[model samples]
Target: MQTNYFYRIYLLLVIFVNAGATVDSNEQSNVGVKVFGPGWDNPQLIFPSRYFFVQHFSDKRVVRVEIEGKVGENVAANRKDCRIWTQVFNETNFDFDMIIVRYKLMSDRCSNGVIIKLFDANNELLMKKETSTAIYAEECVCHNLRWNELMNCDQNSEIYNQLFADLRTFNNSKFNFENSLEEMKRRYAPYTKSYSFCHYAIVNNEIYRKCYGEYVGFAQFMDDMLISLASKTRLPNTQLIVNLGDWPLSDTRRGSIAMPVFSWCGSDETFDIVLPTYEITESVLNMQGRVSLDILSIFGRQNGLPFNKKTSKLFWRGRDSNRLRLKLVDLSKKHPKLIDAALTNFFFFRDEIEKYGPSVSYTSFTDFFNYKYQINVDGTVAAYRMPMLMAGTSLLLKPVSKYYEHFYHLLRKNVHYILVDQELDELLPILRHLIRGKQYSAKKDELPASDEEQAAIVHNMRKFVLKYLLPSHIYCYYHKAIVEYSSLLKDGEIKVSKEMQLVYTAKSKKCNCNKNDANKDEL
Candidate 1:
């Protein structure tokens, strides 16, 4: 009995000496202790089915891992063809005949995580790991931005930084005074009846407004945004036009005025200044108004099921806005257990109702978390619910579109959400891989992400929304946009017309009125 016990103890010591601090728990092996949150320097541990192990340490920017074998050449050779965005890992040392991996690449493309692989001389897979990459958290402060940081954010900042080209154009140009309020109004006249829009002027840090066309919730949402901005900082005197239509005014006609719109697509970037969509802003503000809700509570992340408990099917239900939506329903009908999708309305294609009718009931927003993957198809323009959908714990299968919202540039495909082709040809194959960890491709290199990788992607997305999409960040963006737009005024001159009225209401006054008021808006 004593010899048997000693033999078992000797085997354990030998295993420990060979592998060095075995990390088997998935949670601890992926993300470690980083107070600001886990969007940086959290390298993953991937090994074969055998008892292989490694220990890793990371600061804000660099991660160093030690492997207990002479696998330096294998790691170096396989990393290039791993297709995880090249040139991130380097073999630092071969001391004690072991490999030391020094990972120090900082890229927005690798925001989801970095994939590190090792292959033997015969090109057989030995091990693989996916490490989380750094985002703008360390450098960019989402809550507030100093005046100077505006330009700097555009130049060096990653995720959550809004581009300010129009501001730069007007701020840098010395030749001016040719374009005035009348010229802008005349340029805007041709499209007034075609779409919904409004005009506003900020005078002495107060909101004044005039509306040509009305959309049910749009005007009120804009009022709330301006009120939030006015409460935060003193506004520069300026007048601006806003587009409240479902789609951005994409006409880049000669002499067109630069108007702020909720979304823009393709070449519209040259003419339209994009702002956060009203839908996302309204949802965030509504969540903030609740007594028990906090910044991260906007998406009801607490209600989302644990990854293992979530339903393994992809889910979607919405109006048939595009032809692709109808095709999705047809595909869902054929594979009901795999995909739960149906058109709730058929206004766009009423004639086709006979074939794809019997609309499905609308699912509650919170109930969306029951499924593992959520489908996001473009509706009218960019899907207004994208930010909210992405905030949930479930993975998103988002289709490509020409339209984009203010923060669209921050989103990385297969990082924040899985990118499905417009036609969704690879949808089923991708879903099989993510749901069951089953590879569909015949090619040896086109392997599916492991279960840990899928969960890590979801974690990265939720962290992104928590860090950058808070109510404070949205308000700060509005304030910044106003400040940058004010710089365009010639001679710093701004005038209010007779039609414009002060946009003051009980709701507006309640925000930041005084310290004594318990309802003072929280930044």
Candidate 2:
């Protein structure tokens, strides 16, 4: 009796399948049908997919789709070739059927994440798919102006025009910039016009008492020098004054024993006068706040600034303080002139402080240096030498160095920096290296590695990072993780069930004959 019942059910299923063959040209039609299993877990659940359908109306055609998650699959079709394919799945294992309600293809191209749909004979919706995650073979269509190119380009060249053209293209193709631009402008509106600079007042005990009393007087003089220098340099837009340290202490014990210290009792009064001149005018100020004098002193110790044992001990208080000491070893090796300036500024400030008291004093030429320093005329400036000079010179040279590369590139075309033959020989291999690393992509002949092969590739990448890119410690960590995860595949870390492979395949009638001349009997 059980066998007979099973046979009857099978007969009914066959009858239903046959009944789905009827064609009603005028009636609204549904083509594909996808039936879920008992738990509605269709096979091939491990892979991703999407469903879409095309429908025809009296006046126009429409496409409808329901997406399960974020758009994963992309649809690519060539109307001229009458071919269409989903770019997501590497393989599939299910069957489905769908009916076409509309024949007209839409003229406009859909965006990256849209779903395409089709219908079955019973007007039932069918299969769906998403684009693959693998990188595409096509080159990025966007163009960017490199820092060097931006600095060196001719104002009227085709290259300049092309750069702007690419920018416009990107704006038009990728974003609605109108509203975003306004919001960005509003966010940064507050900091549009503020800038500032700092100067230090120094005092040394070695300086005469008269010089010590005149410390505030010297600070004002130094402030005036900075202002004058700014004027000569035509940096009128700058504002702000910082009186960096050596303010008057209540007792001599409060000062460093190794170096002469001058106190400025009227430091606050002198600052008030200097601050107003440096105030921002009707404009927003964007200023980097002052660095602490203590921190400045530490920086000098680390950078191998010339300091006597007594002065170094006074500044660097602990045994491990030498670890904090910076050896100009690197910079000294690269640029001797820079090192020379560093040393000169250190001693210059030290001497100025000892001779002039902790007041403003001259250091170097206007072109070479423009910072104001307070000098203690009685004592040696050597103890506070590194901190004072390093901090001051860094501020002076930073702007020039920041723009140096840009200027260098701009002048390269006008000046011959290297022989043509030497340039070609050096450039050939560098160009080849860049082309291989930056331009190459795995595509066509180079498909994604198979599960078994990926482990070895990951291992090699980790080894390369450790061996060749050793200095880049961060990349080593990242590559190690990549290798471990990739090796999991080789270790049978994942076990996939057979039911997961049963994907739904939609069915549709293939029009073997011409549509216009099809006979009713032939169909």
Q: State every prediction's TM-score relative to the real structure.
A: 0.63, 0.15
Q: What is the C-alpha RMSD of each candidate to the true structure, in Å?
A: 17.5, 33.6
How many steric clashes between backbone atoms does each model show? Answer: 0, 71
Clashing pairs in 1: none
Candidate 1 Cα errors over 4 Å, as ranges: 1-160, 165-193, 214-217, 253-270, 288-295, 442-448, 505-523
> 92, model 2: CA deviation in Å?
77
Candidate 2 to truth, TM = 0.15
Q: Model 2, residue 58: what's the lDDT?
A: 23
TM-score of 1: 0.63
> lDDT, candidate 1, residue 415?
74
User: Ten residues in a row with the worst lDDT in model 1?
Assistant: 44-53
What is candidate 2's lDDT per residue for 163-234, written digit by digit as tens? 232123223233322232233233322333321112221111010111112123334433433322221111
Tell me the spans in candidate 2 whose CA falls farther than 4 Å from its real position.
1-177, 182-330, 333-339, 343-523
